[model samples]
Target chain A: MKPKYTSLQLFALTALRVSIGWHFFYEGFTKLLNPNWSSAGYLNDSQGWFAGLFHAIAGNQSLLAAADFLNVWGLIAVGVGLLIGIFSRYAALGGMLLLAFYYLSHPPLMNASYSLPSEGSYLWINKNIIELFALWLVFLFNTSSIIGIDRLLKRK
Target chain B: MSNDAENSKLLGRRNLLKALATVPLLGTLTYAGLKKHSNTAANNVEVLNALGFPKNTGLSIKPGAVGTIIHNNNPHIRLGFIGVGGRGRHLMQCAGFAPPEYVQDWMDKHAENPDDNRYQNFLEQDDLNVSVIAVCDVFDEHARLALEAASNADKKGQKDFKGITVKRYKTYQELIADKDIDAVVIATPDHWHAPIAIAAANAGKHVYVEKPMTNNVAETYELKDAVIKSGIAFQVGHQGRQTESYIRAKEVLDKGVLGKISLIEVTTNRNSPNGAWVYDLHPLATPDTIDWKQFLGNAPEIPFSPERFFRWRCWWDYASGLSGDLLTHEFDAINQVMNLGIPHSCVASGGVYFYKDGREVPDVFQAVFEYPNRDLTFLYSASLASERHRGKVFMGHDGSMDMDGVTSVYVDRASIKYKDLLDRNLVNPDEPALTFSSATGNIDAITSPTAKYFAKRGLLYTYRDGKRYDAAHLHIREWLDAIRNKQQPSCDIQQGFEEAMIAHMATISYREGVKTYWDAEKEMIVKGNSVKM
Candidate 1:
């Protein structure tokens, strides 16, 4: 079957995926090098319906430690997989899940209170959810097969 | 749909299956890694437990015999006084042991104003079941005055005090050795605090020592060991522990109202000379009346100077200056509310820029204590030269707490995370938010304009049934009740040790001109490279 998308469209989608991958990779890398860094503070500040769940995770040392490990390593793994276009679909799914967790924790609901400053105002759809859907589009298009390592692997 | 598009979708599903197949393997690897990390975390917890980390004590207020008259069911506790100076006299007044003359003078002064809180508080002291049996001081003036206050119980119109014989001793050792004295209140110079306290503990007498607990780290451990070994009820005079605002702050903190506090700023400011510890020297303090040699004890031998005797807090030889004298109060109050113990490291920098009266300690000081484990930092700043007050503030992720007489919790306005709760009215908005204030109208000590402002907002004292109570009196009553019940007081030996160690870290950092770390396991200050002081 012939590919449907034009080269420019494929290029744009690949660029979005790689850029988002780099963002995730840098965040994970910085946290990895910093011994004192933890997500506990962010979790503790969680608001709205899932606040209790987030607070519980923050309160339990074991759970917090586990979250720290998974969040950091998962970001790095998903970033690498997406950037190189190897296992791109799985990475997209994983990235969507991570972003979903962040979005649910804070939930860009209207009029909710939070200590941290927001990048932009939103009722339900914020940057996290926006990027989450973008990742979904990247997965659906299978942009990796067009211009990523997946293409070479498939050819081999 | 076209046959080519359907065929392409089928191809995409095939590719997705291949990508999904690798995820289970990645999941397996992640699970193994987490298992190894959990074991390491368990070991870390064990180590923390060994170092007395993760304090579990909760705030539980046990009301003592304050504001109530006690029937003489048991024999009164006989208390001996050591260094009957300013603080000692105040404690005596709190214990209802002030001489009849002193009470009469106080009452007479407040006679025109029948609603004076100080006068009322002083009157309430008459019901305390304690008697000053012996008084000791290096200064004859202080000892003689204390003796007069203790012995003269026959003043007209004051029928609560019955005339009791009081003995005056020249030395604390002699006073502590007295078989009739069951307890001792040591309010001597900072250098003499631990020595008298340790001796009194060894002599089987309970002790109430003033703050900073010890002159140095070595004495801190020595005092702790002595009190623990003797099993006496030792109370460090951090009277702010009884402050109602702090007690309520603890309650709010326990509720996680201001979630995950990471930074706290504490401060002290005073504009007056007396506030800077430039206390008045007694006119009668002559070499003949004062046992200058006995007062020197372990301090550097010097000629009889009334300045050193009266303003001991100005010099390092006898006192810890701002860190011990003032910072301890701030630290102890925060510790009571937060249960924050010793910091991992501290860096202090300040100088005696204002008062240049040959003082060994600085008049302006600032210290930063870092607790990496808890991801928190405490900053302390004090200036005796300025009257501008900077109240304590605790910064958390959800909100920040500004603690004064009236503590306030402010939520974050720019928070996206709490948008849902705010919209649903589950939490109050940033403006016109929740606030807590004392029920009592006002109390004494709100003399300053700033204090009056706080008082107007009900910030100062804790109130019960529309009446305010003195924190010092409550603290003293707690100590006495602990003495009667054989239980540890609020600021016990362990608390005193931590308070002294942290306060000393600030002092050492400022004096030595270096950063200091608390070696929690060994319980000692680890000094860094020295800089110019």
Candidate 2:
């Protein structure tokens, strides 16, 4: 029982989803191609609330490899699912969870700092949090079902 | 056509369009990703060529390729220690021996916290196939502890370890003369390092003595002769020679990356009583429990004081203080890279500025050496009251290198050698030109200040097969490998002689209040105005 959207609203929302999906896909794809890429550096530089957990994962090789694996492939799976509106609701939620991890691991706290540079200064809200918010809206809206593969599936 | 047929055909077309609408974008993404990848690779080659490193593939000297080559049939070396103090025990641990209590404690630490990898690294250390058979220390307590550690050759828990007869030789001479011992690790005071090593070398046992390898120039010459005459493997304990970053530093220096190097500044910063060598007097130390006369060993004859016995580094009679104790390390690290063998002249100055304790050695000191041939100056400085690390820096006309745990290079702003790079914005003066990590053999461009921060911390290291190697352990392993393979170690007696001479020159300069000069042609420390001004 979602609310109806105007054609313009639907187009804009769909474009936002596709853009985010493309960004996630490219990031994960590049990491997959780079044989030496690992999440160790980013995890070691993790600050804020979940630093302890992140550092622990980074210290152990096996756990670090698993974390790197999940991070790379999870992004790809979520991106592909969201792109074509295949299980678009679940994909949106998964993307939100990943964003939450990123936000918490290195949140823009007033006193805390990061060794990984940010593109811009922020206060309690970075690009990760912004994307998470956008994904939340994407989850609430039904543009994907209206004009996506979900539309064709809905016929059956 | 019927109305139902027309409606069905239109619905099928709309559904087909909707279901596959964004699929074409995936094809477009593939094209873009492929294009970006190829462009990045081409850009990398262009940058390499611009830097005049077209042939550079990876590390100039890959540690994996030239690292310790442990033969399958390596001999089992029987080791005996002359001193079992803190440093002595660490050397023993590096040689694959740790007391049962420490073994259990390490295990407990790992069990309490999974992230504690010290115990894990100890376990993963290669079995050097060696055992301690004899130990000699002036103190009763240290000798007893050495015996306990020696018997735990397996480096395992208490239950797993069975006892062995670790003979406690009351004197180093007795320990060296033991027929069963194949090598002697001399970790005694500076005064005892040469005499004991000389005696051990004469006794046909290989020697690994701590640095400053000898207390004076005379001893240095005599020890070199004795080692050569004995025909035994001799290694000086400069563990930094085994440090991966330092190895890479040498390779880079040989390439003349820091062109026209004019100055090399090395520093030591510490702030603690222990750091100042004000070690606590052992409560158990007494004339009955300690060999006072034996500990004197050519030092001035005096009534035994527990402070003198425990804090021997604070005295001129036993050790050469900051010059020989600390500065030798910095000097040797430079020597390892630049091969600045023996400086032409040295001038040193300092006093007991920070620690007011009745110690002959200065707590803050500095020394400068002139390498006239190379047109370079080496400056060394120290402060025992400050913990701020002013790292070792090699300054040059083209660039500068700052080395400690990592080596980072920064191009000079007005560098003519790199003028093209600067103008093209390929390299930045404010940012690091390159950050080299020996762990991965990768030189990364520092694009941001944040990346530079992490680069300094050396966070790029990943576990090599989930095992960590200690530099000291590697040093000991190399010595053993040399012994087995019948080759001289990296820091052989020849290198040790140079280290001792330079360190002695600094010591003599500070003590005599005059500039000291090493007449390399005559191998003499000319004290007066013997050299041309």
Candidate 3:
């Protein structure tokens, strides 16, 4: 297949995927090493429409444990998959879903509130939603075959 | 759109569908794992109860008959006084101990007004049947003064307490050994509190020990075990346990009025030298009068300095410093309202900044305790050099409670969960939705400077039927009633153990310069080492 996009555009798209992969990998790795760490505090302080659902999960010990394991491992799996450009599209899909859950847990919609200090103000969109869209672009562009391990595998 | 972009979008859509299909499979696996690993629903109820919210709205072991004295037609409980210093003298007074000169002076000071509540309460002490049969102290003057006060109970104009004879003992062991003494009140230095209480428990005598309940973590566990084995009534001296505002706060908390508390801030402040534990050394506290050896029981033997004898709270050898002397009060008060047993880990930092005297404890301190399981954090701070009063603040998602002298719950203006309630005026936003104030009349009417300060801060007492009752008196009455009823007092040994462990963790963290943790399985404080402040 002949190259479709300019080289610079392809490079930018690959860089975005790598950067997001690094962010997810670091978060998961840090949490994995800290045995006592839990997401209960964040879930318990969830705001907006899904607050009750988040609280219910937080209150359920078994459910919370499962959620913590899945969340941490899923982040690592997706990050590694995306970083190596193996199953990159699937990684983007999984990342977007996780980001959606984060957005729903504490949506930045107007009038939604939280007691914890915020880093910045947002109306209807925040970092999670923005990253979800960025992941979508990465998934649509399918740059893995252009410069990633997917290209080497295809050559075989 | 470009043909290449369209082709990419089609490919992405196909891939998204395949990935999305795996989510439900993962969800099913997760559900199966949770079902296999999670505790039963019934177990969650127990976990929630352990997290400080029991099914019972009232945490009191015995709920009704809080302030009333039930005679049960039993003989007056024989009581003994141990370590009768400032706090001991106060407890003695609460138990109807008043010398003739003291009563007469109080009456004269109050202009002989028969309606004066303090004097009136003394006159109405016919119902408090506790008879002080023994007095003990290492200090001769303290023991003598306690004996004199106990002997002059008739001076309160109460005919029932006439001609009482209180025998004096030179040591707590002798006092506890007395056959006639049915119960013992311990208001000694922190080092002596647990030893005397444990001995009293083993001697088949009820105990009322001052807080912090033990000098160290090991003593706390030992005292708790002794009390449980002995099955005697044990009350830790956290008088605020009986405060009306705390009871009301507990009720409100049980009702979930201030939903899901995540953070609590408690503070203590004092400006006077005496409040900083620079207590006055009695002029007669010489080596001849004070049995310095007896007073230094289990503590390092130091030359008899009147400062160490009178102000032992300033030293680590005899006390837990601010953690035991002051933080315990704040912790107990909050515990009564919130039932916060203990924190998982604590980090503390402080130092002796103000009083340059040769004291060992810090004059300013701050500690943060993290409760990972409960998803809560408690912050405690104290300063002896500043008079700026900071009360306890419980911050929750729906509302926040500010409890200083009064208890007030304010709805969070930006509360998403309670937005509809706020909009419909179900929860008011302008003012506190619930307010509990113990003050009813003019604050100046309270004569004692101490009483005035407490009343101003809503700490000393609470009003019932338009009449004020001292929290200490109420607390003592509760202990006596528990003894007669064979029920647990408000602040029992288990509760005391929890309070002491947390307080000791803060002290240890500050002294050892490390984060402290509770080893629940071992029932000990982790990384705890006794370091001089």
Candidate 4:
């Protein structure tokens, strides 16, 4: 027997998917506009556990050169996949992976200093935290319906 | 009394057992839950407070008037001016200095002794309203001189300075103890800056200390934490910091007008001897009136040398040299513009080439710092010498900016082209077909077959603009208003602390000849030779 979810549960799951998908898709599109994009800039400028990774990439001229091409394509692919809900689970996972790389590369929390409690403390809510939370929701809900290619592909 | 009687009537062995066992258990659970809630609430308050927001006040729409002056809803602060020396005096002479009627006349009668010329021009300005209520200095002569100036101005119908009484404080300790004084404007020597600020905060007084908040790294954090806990205002005197031009430039940069910035180069240079820390030695300072011991404060105990006491910027004990003074201001301006705090790590190298005044800090210095977002290469070369590359240049991948009184942003258009359009495809080859028209003998080859496929090539666009800013007075006005309204200022104590923290890291890098990194989560620099110190 197939498992059945309540109407409320189904609605919640669908809402979670759409919100996270839209967020990921928008972020990817914006990053795609710029010509000059690379991990090396973030790498050389970061000082954390991943400093060595940044330093290694910074020294690799050939790899740094290829990063521009990869970044543009990566963002576009991630955006389309999320927005259309094509390969829905994979898209969600990919968005998280890309954000994780960017987060580790620069780690916004490590360098930010707040004037008030709201500005600096790495509490439950922040940009990185929000994005990570959205990614987690995608995993939790496992939703791929409503204006999605996944449902259509399943029917076929 | 009724509740107690009822409790006694209902008392039984089972009831007692239940009360004793279950009630205590429930009480413990309630206490634990309440504590958890309290911790969460405290953290929430802390976060809201740091973000310039309060739970009860509701969310405010932060106005983005970058190059425009927006009149803030703040009250007129009753400013009490302490020092009337160089920078202090200049600020007072401005049109915005005068206070109201009651205090203006009292300042007039007290300054009748000396017919001083310095206060003459200041009195003539009708709008100058910085009410000089109290002016204090260690040297009784300078104190007397400043008092006399305020008195002369007051007598000459400069009614705003009317009730200004010049009190002679032999030490900053006396000024700190004064119950009437709400805040202090510290224009003291570099060594005394931190101590006086700390003392003022402890005495429940706000401090607007002259730039480079401290001479060392450790003191900066301590002072920052102290001010935060005390719930008082602190405005670090890097006057140009909150200017419109800088603020606008920052907005544009953050908006990615420069396109994923990776490199920032900042420079502070000077041509003249005065700019190079070559000030003529004053003959008046002596051990009797100057209070050399008080000047030293928390610095290592050393003999009273007149040079160290007067031109304190030259000595390491009293100053961080040009880095702390000049470069710090630039660094702060740059940081404020970018909204970046301390860099992840910094490496500095430089030495003193000229002006062997036995000063410990080098006349020249350069440091490369790695911020979380990007890398900042800072260079400070001061000579009793040449002025080349004298201004600050902030170079980002999208564009570059230069800072004077105004900050100018310039973009290189070609830096933003779409990627796939620029790449050549060698996967498939097509041969050109030559054909002759029946009517004409002209042969045309199929031109641009590649145009049939792929998207249009988009050009990378460059944009540039410049603006001049006057925000020192505005910043002060904003702070005063916040105090009156119980609102937070733009750059509060915590923001000031972040700016000061970067200077400490730079100092660490320069002093230890090693890279310095800060662990933001830990609120400490990761252990290194520089951080260890």
Best by lDDT: 2
**What lDDT tens digits, residue by residue, belong to model 2 across residues B331-436?**
8899988889989999999999878888899999999999999999999999999998799999989888887777888888888888887887777787667766
DockQ of each: 0.02, 0.51, 0.01, 0.01
How far residue B351's Cα lies from its native spot in candidate 2, in Å, is 2.2
TM-score of each predicted structure versus truth:
0.63, 0.92, 0.63, 0.53
Q: Write the per-residue lDDT of candidate 2 for residues A1-156, one digit (tens) a residue.
A: 435888899888888887877887777887777665777788888888888899999877799989999999989877876777767778899999999999988989999877777779999988999999999888888566765677777667
**Runs with alpha carbons beyond 4 Å of true place in candidate 1:** A1-156, B1-75, B115-117, B152-164, B420-432, B440-460, B464-467, B529-533
Name the better of 3 and 4 by TM-score.
Answer: 3
Report the lDDT tens digits of candidate 1 across residue range B206-310: 999998899998889899999999999889999887666666667668867667888999998887899899999888989998898988888889999999989
| DockQ of candidate 2 compared with the true complex | 0.51
Task: Put down candidate 3 lDDT per residue, A1-156, tens digits, no spaces.
Answer: 524779799778877887787677656765665444466656876888888788878756698999899899989887766665767889999999999999999898778776544679988899999999999998898877665556545555
Per-residue lDDT over A30-54 for candidate 4, one digit per residue giving the tens place of the 0 to 100 score? 4443222344434555555675666
CAPRI grade, predicted model 2 = medium
| Full-model lDDT, candidate 1 | 0.75
lDDT of 4 at B527: 38
- Evaluation by lDDT, superior candidate among 3 and 4: 3
Decide which is better by lDDT, 2 or 4: 2
* lDDT, candidate 4, B1-533, per-residue tens: 99988777676443434223212332343356457546644654543342223546642312233322334533223334554455565454441442233134434543662323224433433332234446666555456555555444443444324444555566677767877776667777676677778888888777777777776667777788778777777777776655544554554555454456666666666666677666665567677766666667677788767677656778777778766787677777777777667667766777777767677877777766676545444444444445665556666564555554334444443434212211322111122121111111111222122211100110111111212222455455545545555555666666667666666676777787767787777777653654431
The regions of model 2 sitting more than 4 angstroms off are A1-3, A47-52, A107-113, A117-127, B1-40, B50-52, B55-60, B159-164, B445-452, B460-467
